[model samples]
Target: MIAKSNEARCTSCHAGYGWKGNDFDFTDQTGVDCLVCHEQTGTYKKFPAGAGNPAPREMVFPGNGKTYHPPDWNKVAQSVGRPTRNNCGTCHFFGGGGDGVKHGDLDSSLMKPNKMLDVHMGTDGQNFDCVRCHSTTLHNIAGRVYTTPAYEHRKSLIEDDLASKITCESCHSSSPHKEDAKANDHTDKVACQSCHVPRFARVNPTKMWWDWSQAGKKKNGKPYKVKGELERPEYDTLKGDMKWAKDVVPEYYWYNGSIEHLTVKDVIDPGKDVVINRPVGDKDDIHSRIFPFKVHRGKQPYDKVNKTLVVPHLFPKGPADADAYWKTFDWGKAIAFGMDYTGLPYSGEYDFVETSYVFPITHMVAPKDNVVACKECHAHEGGRLAKLTGFYMPGRDNFRALDTLGWIVVIGALLGVVLHGLGRVFTANGRKEQ
Candidate 1:
């Protein structure tokens, strides 16, 4: 037992990374002693790093240890403090491009112990914890050799399955750019960020940190910041309540064209008179927009059934006026579905598939720069926009267009008097000539 005290536990007990282990034998105490890991010169030489920390109980951890007693478990747990990315970053983060740590994040600042609160909202907003989006469950976030899908939602099935990427999809709405496409020709994703964001840029839910040293120096050193501006999206005010993060990137949009509905058109020929070159088929992909999906606090792998975040009236700003809105009308839209309508005569090579059936490409428009009210889209009167046609004269916005019409009518009446006088002069001259 005395000799065991000198030697520490083997790799197995250390849990490889000092987290927890399956066969943890504190008694085995292999490899190195507690003093070594604790940074002590000898037995009983350890003290807490911070000033004024009370001297720890003069005992060693029990169970596997050969000597000494463990600290009061409850006292330690209470003082454990909030978890932070720093704990993970100590080993995971590397900016200078060395030691297999390349998430391509342009940040070099080291993580701080209690800084989580500053990065994300506290346990009162929709997003309570910062770790909800940054880290993973079951520990040590897993990633492939060539990491892809910079964020979880945009990640493909090729990287992580639908489940692992669920968090990404939830926050970033997955619906069509438009809500009810059949009613209002909403095109690409309206959340906007989904479209306009540079391929892999993401916001830091933890802390907004960047590496001044490596930021400007490109891989080839030709002024890396010279890269074109990262197109950030802009979000509209929520029912005149609040605005979203100013840095969000929206989609690239432009009017493709117009169509009443998205469906397939039928083509007909009688008695095989027309040599059928193309086959007719089906378009089955159909999507819909059900706004305000349920969102709870936390990050990746969001549990849909039961969970919620702490949303305050305001803190970073002030307590929220009311509880968090929780759901979002943004990012809700429909998609096209496809199907096979034609029964082909042959099996494989000669099998016919429909080319005409598609989500009428004519209706798919891109997001444009200039924003106009939905009413402005149609110029028809008695429509939503036309009904807005009221007095629209700009006089400190004091006068309406209809107001100007009233003034014009009054001036016309006065002009009639002068015209009558001129007519009398002409009539008198005509009588003299007679």
Candidate 2:
């Protein structure tokens, strides 16, 4: 999707200033906007379409209708401090267009959460900042996306000197439950987030489904928007049909930290569901554990002849642009432009193909009282872990032969006990006569 986006629109949240093209210098430390992360002043704002530049003068952005004011350089410089929740949330909460859009576990609600919402980030509870877990070294933050391994070895801070402090195991050791050995034992097979964070999008609704095939529908002369069940725009002329949900029960998967992704040029089967990325592990893998994920399903364009996914130019450069899907609403022109930009060949004929992308749920740490109960995943029917097979869960799995043998053993033991008691009673009379 980065290929479909304009740098001006996409890089405002991530890339520092003047990163409009490939020629942008990556080694220049001066270009790095330290104020964006370190400034204590809440006034520091990046222009939405400024390609990582702040507003030169006071002006409103035409895209989002938000007014931007040039920061007072002296005031901001004096207020330089460690990054706060607001500093990190400024970019992360707004990723993928708006708040709670990209990541269901992260949103503006976390900024001032209560203990019930998040035990760590809650202002009324532990009140831990983002840096508390995501320790930084030379500005290379500790956390990595699920597509890559965050830690080579899983160990607590006291266990190893080289272990990453980002993992939950780093702080809360492998055996965190003090009294419950059963729960502590489950840690080996289940991820901490899988049980600790039972559901995601607990506070705000997140987009669960998107259909790009339904895009380009416009009202007479101008593009229009329609609100859906969540009171948010479900159908947009630019994007398409979207379905939103809150308090979402996450889909479970066996993840070993690393993942495999489908590249833009990779061949895909049009008949099957195109997985954007998949976790790389199985039940047998030693490092793998049952992790929770928010699966976002969608339908997007793919070349029928080339048998590859096509990236459409989605953001418009300006009002006069014709190829961008936002402005022109022409899939052919947008796909052609985006493909040319990426130096990939695209067949003239294109059709929509189903796709699925997953985001790991790692945030929204609930209190101990709110943790998922044992029966949620260990019950005989409709369990959270019903889809997971090959493992013999104590209460959930049953074998007919094993049950029959167990019952026979119990019956034989009871019969032997009764016969021994009867024999002892019969011998009591003879012993008295002797």
Per-model lDDT: 0.25, 0.86
Taking the tens digit of each residue's C-alpha lDDT, what string does model 2 give over 1-434?
A: 65334777777776556676656765777767888888998999988888778899998997678899999999999999889999999988767888788888988888889888899888998998998888888788888775678776789988986666788999888999987778889888899999999899888788888899999898997888898877767998888998889999998999898878999889999999999998777999999999998888999999999999987888888888899988888999999988988788987889999999888889898999899999998889999989999989978899979899999999999999889888878888479668
Off by over 4 Å in 1: 1-78, 89-93, 97-102, 106-130, 134-137, 140-162, 165-167, 176-434
Which 10 residues in a row give candidate 2 its minimum summed lDDT? 1-10
Error of 2 at 179 (Å): 3.6
lDDT score for residue 171 of model 2: 86
TM-score of candidate 1 relative to the true fold: 0.22
Model 1 Cα lDDT, one tens digit per residue, 1-434: 01111112222122232312234344542422232223211222212210112124554422123334334544443443334443334223332112111222211222321122122222222332335444455543432111132232334345454444323343444443356643233322222222222211123211111211121122353321221122211111211111112121211221111112211222322222222111111122122111110111111111112121111111011133122111121111000000111111111111111111111111001123322334432434432223222323122223456678877887877788768777878787478778
| Top TM-score hit | 2
State residue 338's C-alpha deviation in candidate 2, in Å: 0.7
Q: Please name the candidate that would achieve the greatest lDDT relative to the true structure.
A: 2
